[model samples]
Target: MYDRPYPGNLYIHEILNGHDVRAYNYFRMPAQVFTGLRDLLADRGVLRDTRFM
Candidate 1:
């Protein structure tokens, strides 16, 4: 059989983009809050996006 089409990041993107309730249900935080935290960490050099990530 062929591999599944959607990758992990795409799935995450769907969840984050879909609805506030979905993001909250999965992460226990609203989408805005989660994205804010991610941005903060990236600014602090605490998180980096790599090709694999």
Candidate 2:
């Protein structure tokens, strides 16, 4: 998500809540995978907002 900046945000000039919902779907991804992706995003300077994660 972070890699894409406005990940999953297709709306024109609107906040993209799709990625948030995707991340919130715990059943979709493993906990470790989600954490790893989040960390990766943070490390790569994609996750600028800590509160978002």
Candidate 3:
């Protein structure tokens, strides 16, 4: 079902790297905080990176 060449993570990355307001509009949280939370989850094994993800 995942057909987009950019994929979700890449799109998120782009949003995070772009304007802070865009990230907030998309995630409802600041980019830095969101990134920190994501990293924490991944480091704690709460998030996993899959081929399709």
lDDT of 2 by residue, 1-53 (tens): 34545634233112223355444463366545666786899999997753433
Cα error, candidate 3, residue 32 (Å): 0.3
lDDT of 3 by residue, 13-36 (tens): 788999999999989999999989
**TM values, all candidates:** 0.83, 0.42, 0.76
Runs in model 2 lying further than 4 Å from the true structure: 1-27, 51-53
TM-score of 2: 0.42
Native-referenced Cα lDDT, model 1: 0.87
Model 3 off-target regions past 4 Å? 1-5
Question: Which residue runs of candidate 1 sit more than 4 Å off their true CA positions?
Answer: 1-4
- lDDT at 30, model 2: 50
Model 3: lDDT equals 0.87
